[model samples]
Target: MNTSPRILVVEDDRTVRTVVNDYLSGQGFSVTAVDNGSEVLARFAAERPALVVLDRMLPGLSGDEVCRALRATSDVPIIMLTALDAVPDRIAGLESGADDYLAKPFALKELKLRIEALLRRSRQAGAAPSEFGLGPFRVDPARRHIRRDGVPIPLTTREYELFLYLLNNPGRTISRDEILREVWQWQFGDPSTVTVHIRRLREKIEEDPRFPVHLKTEWGSGYRFDLRGGEG
Candidate 1:
């Protein structure tokens, strides 16, 4: 039998942690639970989970901080859990490198769906090739490495997958719903999550993230990956 997918849960709340852990395990996942941001990196290195459920408010290291730090080294998928409902707060989480987000007091079913969606995307992206180039960035999918102007730029697993998706479909506008389905494998659409990942991708790949030349926003639509160096 195949080993269950490993999941790392980084939340300070005991009740929330237990609920997620128990629920995911019952769904046939292997879970490692940890509290505080301080331990996330170490646990991640050791556990090498297939995905991470990280809380936005963490002791020692904030969820965003942890996500950013992890992005600097690895491409592990991270889904942030937070109580903040503000748009800015959601953006902040995405900008900090989270792959997806879930507001607190969320339904367990929703969380399960998100986890499964992320995992499916990861698996699909991994099974494909290891080399892709778009704009100024080049990615070796087999090695899971990305470089800009020949200088290595590290990306987490989710970031790499997002980048790959954009590269594979340049110039065409991809709706948030499509991104959710293709990148997150979410049948139930989540535009907020798509927005966050796109924002984070811009920060990593664009020389000027505030005015990106590659990842272009489509105003009322979603986003387009401009590979020809032209503004959308």
Candidate 2:
């Protein structure tokens, strides 16, 4: 069913583009190469690549603009590539919807590693669940729907993915690093993003988001979903 990961590479530099394309292709990914933001949306619609390698500076649509546009319509995993090394720039990229970021002049090996890690995380986060029961919440992964005692609950794409991850690994203390790696497709992430999303999910799924019983924080460790409340 074409399970191999698909990647879209958007870069204007011919040398970097060729290198990345060749390297990723060697790693057995179906790759679609493009040079500017003008063609990104069209190709994305046609190919629907599982992940994207987006350069921050593009000819037509700047990487930030492209990322914003794509996020409005899709939640495809994006790894932003940029030469800007400022902390604010990196934070801006993440805030703008990049799943990960890599500074330019990056080692090919490191880039490949990051791509592989992101792909793995994407697959795990999106893993289909026949049905998952967490306390009173029941989720159908295939349909991306959730219900509490038969009452439907609405969730955004990111919230749904985070909920599924917690449900799938009930009772396991998931570190921020683990959550970012598994759900966000990034080795490192802005911790605020994790906290913000968790808060949002708690609001939707928990009977009382203020004192969440299902999703609990573990002091300095991380967060976990305690289905049995550790009493059974």
| Error at 44, model 2, angstroms | 1.0
User: Tens digit of lDDT per residue, candidate 2, span 42-143?
Assistant: 999999998899999899899999998888787777888999877777767766677677889999888877787666645554667587677777887766
> Tens digit of lDDT per residue, candidate 1, span 69-108?
8877777788889899788898888888787788888998
CA lDDT, candidate 2, residue 43:
97
RMSD of each: 2.9, 5.1
Which residue pairs in candidate 1 have backbone atoms (N, alpha carbon, C) closer than 3 angstroms, thus clashing?
75-156, 75-157, 130-141, 130-142
Predicted structure 1, TM vs. truth: 0.81
lDDT, residue 66, candidate 2: 91
Alpha-carbon deviation at 211 in model 1, angstroms: 3.7
**Candidate 2 Cα lDDT to native:** 0.80
Best by TM-score: 1
Q: Clash pairs of candidate 2?
A: none
Per-residue lDDT, model 2, residue 148, is 80
